[model samples]
Target chain A: MNRDAPCQDEWSILVVEDHPATRQFMKLRLRKAGYRVMAAGDGREALEILKHHFCPLVITDWMMPEMDGLDLCRAIRQESWEGYVYIILITAKDSQEDIVRGLEAGADDYLSKPVHPAELLARLQTGRRILELERTLKERNQEIARLSITDPLTGIYNRRYLNDTLTVEVRRALRYKRPLGLLLCDLDHFKRINDTYGHNVGDLVLKEFAGWLQGSIRGGIDWLARYGGEEFVLVLPETDLAGSFDLAERLRRLVAEKVIATPAGDITITASFGIASFTPGGPENHPAPETLLNEADQFMYQAKKSGRNRVVGPTGNQ
Target chain B: MDIENTARNLGIGRDELLEVLEIFLEASVADLEALTEAVAAEDRSRAGAAAHSLKGAALNLGLTEVADLARTLEMAAKDGVLLGAEGQLKDLREKLQDLTQAIQA
Candidate 1:
C-alpha cells in the first residue's frame, strides 16, 4: 500500500483464449515476462471479470464460443468506465481485411497466432507505456481540480468553493429542515500589521491563522474557507444558534491566546467573529444564502465597532 | 514437431510445453469429432467453421502440419469445393493421432 509505488494490479493483463491450452500457455509466457496475468476461457467470462476487476490490458483470441474478441472489444468500448482499456486481438486471420475488421471493432492492436512470445512482450510494453501515460494524465487532472478549489496563499478552500458549497449546504438544510450555522471571522487591525511589519509577515500570519482555524474545526462536521483577504468563513452542519455561539467564543479565545513568531519578533493578534444560524421553519421560511451571509457580515461589523476581538449574533456579547 | 524449440521461443519450460500438448490433445478429440460430423452431414459452412477453430488451436500450439491441413480443408469448404474434402479430413485425422501419440510418449 505504498503511495509512491505503482502496484502490480495496475499493470495486470487479462488473457482470453477459448482454447484452454493456449490460454494456459499465454498466461505462463506473460507471467514469465513479469506481468501479472489472469486468464478467461472465452470473451464472455472475460467480460464478467472486466466488470469487477481493473485490468487495462486484454489479450484475446478472435474466435471463441459464446463471445469473441471483437465482440468483447465492442462491449468494452460501450462501457462507461473511468479508465481506458487497451485490447489486442490474437488470431490466425492475418489478412489485411481481417486486420482492418479488428481495428474497426475497437481493438487497439492485433497479434497473429502462433504468437511470438518476444513480439507479444514487446507489444505489451507499448501498452504499458500508453497506460502509464494515461495514469499520469489522470493524476495530473485530479491535482489540477484540487488546486483550482484551494487558496494559494492560505492553503485553504478558496472563496469560489465557499460560495458554491454554501448554496448547496443551504438547499440541503432547507430541504431537510435542519439547523445550519455560519461564522464570518476577520483578523483585527490586519492592514496596520501589513503596513508596519511587511507583506511577507502579513502573509505568514495569514497562513498561520488559517492553519490554526483548520486545526480547531471538526474534521467532518465543520469546514473552513478563506473567504477573502483577512476574512474567513466557517460552516457548521447540524448546529443550532447556541452551538454556533459556543464555537465562536472558543475560536475567538484560541486565536487571542496564540502568539505567532513573525520575522520581526513574536507578535500577538486577535480576530472578530460574527455567528449566525438558520433554523428551517418551512418552505416559506427558507432564506437565500446571501441573506444569511449578509446578516453575518453586518454582525461582524458590529463586533468590530464594539471593539475588535469579540463575537456578535443571536447569542451576542457571550 | 520441434516442440522443444517452440517452447523455448514461447519462453516456457519443457514441463509447461508438455502440459499444453496434453490439453490440446484432449480438446482436439472433441473438435475432430465435430469436424467428422459436419463432413458427414455435408454442411459446408459448419465444416468450414469447425476446421477454422481447429486450425487456430493447432497453430497456437505450434502444430504446423495439423494447422496447415485444417487450413486447406477450411479453404476448400469456403469455396464450396467439398470434393476430396473427405480425404483431406482423413489426413487431418492421422496427423492429429500422430500428435497425440507423440505428446503421450
Candidate 2:
C-alpha cells in the first residue's frame, strides 16, 4: 500500500467472506475506489489480520465457516483500539431476527449480498467522513493542550502548568533523592512601577526582563513561568542549591542590566528572587511546599530589604 | 480560624525560619562588607560575589528591594562593568545593614 499520501495513510479496508468469488469481486470494487484491501478467507484469518493491522473499516460476510461474521463482529467490538472500526455484515439472511442478531453482535450496519456496489460505496464514504472528522478533532485537542501550558504575554510556561508539573517534580525529587530548586522572582516595587509609570512601561520592563531570562536559560527540561502579577518562576529539576544559585545569579544579573524602552521613555527596573531547594526539607524535617514557598517569599523580601535585583537561596556553603 | 492557630499556620513562631534568617543575615553583612571594600578597590569579581551573596541572603529573607540592589551591583561586576552609580551602592549597603538589624530584632 502506498501510504505516502495523507489520504491513503489510514485508508485500509479489511474484507472477510467464505466464498472466494464474491470476496474477489468486492476486493476489486474497493481497490478501484482507491482503498487498500486485505481479505481473509474466514473468521480466523480475519482475526489475525485485525490483530496485525489497524483496519479502521471492516466488511464481513454474516455467515461463514467456523467463527461466523457475527462472532467476529462481537470480537472486534470487545477489543480496544483507538480508531473507529466500521463492520458491515453481508448476508443473504435478511429476516428481522437475523438483522437483530447481527446488530447485537456489534455489526455497525447490515447489507444483504449479492452486495450493491452503490450502497456499499455510500456506507464506506460515511465511515471515511466520520474518521476524517475524528482526526481533525484529535489534532485540535493536541493544539489546545500546547496553548494551555504557555503564558501568552512572555511566551513562557503559565502558572497553572507550573503548579501541576511541579507537584510531580516535587514527588520525583523526594523519591530519587536528587535536589530540586525553586526560584520565585518578582519585580521590586512593581506595583509602584505600574501605578506611577503606567502599565505600558511596566509591560515593557517585563518583556525586556523576560527576554534576558530566555537568553541565559539553557536546557529543554528547565521550566520557566510568569507565576502572576509581577511574579515569575523557574523549576530546576535535578538541580541542587549550587546549580540553582549559579543560574539564579545569572538570571538576576541579566534582569538588572539596564532600562527597557517604552513609549514614555527608557526606565530601569529591578527584581528580587527567593530560592529554596529540596534540603531534606520534607514535611517532617522542615515544612511542606507551601511552607517552603513562604520561606522563599520571606527571603525575597529580605533581598528587597537588602537591595533589589538579587538572587537568594539556602547558602551553598552550608 | 482561631487567631492562635491562624498565627501558627502563618509560621509566626519563627524558630527554624529565624535561625535560617539569622545565618542569612550574617552572610549578608559579610557579603555587603566585601562588596563595599571590593567596589572601593575596583575589584569586580570580589564585589560581584559579595553583592551576589547578599542578594542570595536577601532572597532567603524575602527582602526584595535589598536583593534587587545587590543584584544590580552583582551584574555590573559580572560584566566587568563598573556601575557609574557608586552612590547607589552605598545607599543600598546602608539599607542592607538596616535590614540585618531588623531581622535580628
Candidate 3:
C-alpha cells in the first residue's frame, strides 16, 4: 500500500527466501503491495528468472537451499545487463560481518529479519523510489544529450554532434565497406539579403529555407544538420554519388523556386550544393574525413563561383 | 499618421509595427481612390470592397475604434448609402493618418 508501488502495472519484484513459511508470507505481502511477484527458493532459480525477465528490484535472503544469496548477487552484478536492480538482502544473520559481506557481494540494501510488516514496507518503498529516480535521471540525460547536438536557430543537428556521430558512421561504413554520401549546401547571396533587407529579413529567409528542406527530406537513414550559417549538410547512408546528386538537384531547384512570403512581398532565394561520396580510386581516393569535408566544401564554393543555384561534385579533379 | 503608436498599442516592435502600417497605408490609399470613384459612380460593390479591406487591416493592428468606423462605412456603402458614410470614413481616415504620423515620429 506504499505510494512507491505505482499501481503495479509493469514493475515486477522477485522474492528469494528459502523457507516455505517466510517465502509464502513475503509473496503474500508483495502481491498485496501491487508487485507481480516471482518466488525463487535459491540463487540458481532466481538467475534463471533474471535471464529471461528484467526485474528492477530484487529481495533476497542470505541462506538458501542451493547457491546462496551472496553468490546470486555476485552473479547478477557480473551479467551484461545495463540496467540497475535494487537488491535488498533480508536475513536473520544480522552480524556486522555477514551484513558487510552481503553488501560487498552487490546487495544494494540490507533488511534485518523478524522483518516487521512496517519495516518490510519501508524497504520496498526505498527500492521503488530509487528505481523511479534512476529512470528519470536516465531520460533527462538523453534529452540533454539530444539538445547538445542540435543547432539553436535551425533546429537541426549542429557541427559538434555531426563530428562526433559522422566519424563513427564513417568508420562503420569503412568497416562494412558501404557507400556513404555527404552533401554540402550554401544559400546563395545570403550576405546580400542581410545587407539589403536587414538581419531580421535574413533570419526569416533562413527559417523559410530550413522549412523547405524539412518538407522535402523524408528518409529514415538521412542525417540532416545545419553545418554553419547559410550552410547545411546531409549524410546519406548506403547512398552513392548519383543518388546524392539527384537529391541535391531536387533540393537546389526546390529552393530556387520556393517563394518566401515576407512583409516585403515574396522573396525568392536559391542555394548552391556540392556532393561527394566514397569512390574507389577516384579524385578524392584515400582522403581523410576532413578531406571529404574540404572536398565537399570546395565544390560548394565552386558552385558559388561558377554561378550559383546548381549542384557540383568531384569531377575527378583536385 | 503615426503607425509606431499603433504598433506600440498592439505590443509589437515599433519597426515591424511600422512596416505593417506602411503596408496598410499603401493599401488604404489605393482603396480610398477606388471608394471615391465608386461613390461618384454609385457603385456599391466597389465601395464595399475598399471599405472591407481597410477595416480588416485596421482590426489586425488592434485599431478596433478605427475599425468600427471603417466597418460602419463599409456596411453603409454596401447598401448604396454613401451620404453619412463619407463623414465616418473621413473620421477613420483622420485617425489612421494621425497614428501613422505618430509612428513615423
Best candidate (score: TM-score): 1
Error of 1 at A200 (Å): 2.6
Best by lDDT: 1
lDDT of 1 by residue, B13-50 (tens): 88899898888878878877887887777788888888
Candidate 3 per-residue lDDT over residues A1-318, each given as its tens digit: 223344545568888865543455556556666778898889999999888887888999776657889999999999866478989987656789998999999999998654555566677778788889998999999999889998878787889988887887677677677787888989998999999888888889988887777667665778778888989888887878887888888998899878998776789999999887885445544556676688799999888888888889966322
* Model 1: lDDT to the true structure: 0.86
Stretches > 4 Å off in candidate 1: A1-10, A282-284
How high is the lDDT of residue B94 in model 2? 80
TM-score of 3: 0.67
TM-score, candidate 1, first chain = 0.93
lDDT (10s digit) by residue, model 1, range A140-182: 9999999998999988999889989999999999889899999
Instruction: Please identify model 2 stretches exceeding 4 Å from their true place.
Output: A1-10, A143-149, A189-220, A258-269, A280-287, A316-318, B1-105
TM-score per model over all chains: 0.93, 0.63, 0.67
Q: Cα deviation in Å at residue A155, candidate 3?
A: 2.5
List model 2 lDDT by residue over B7-67, tens digit each.
Answer: 2332333443445445555556666677778887889978875675555445423456776
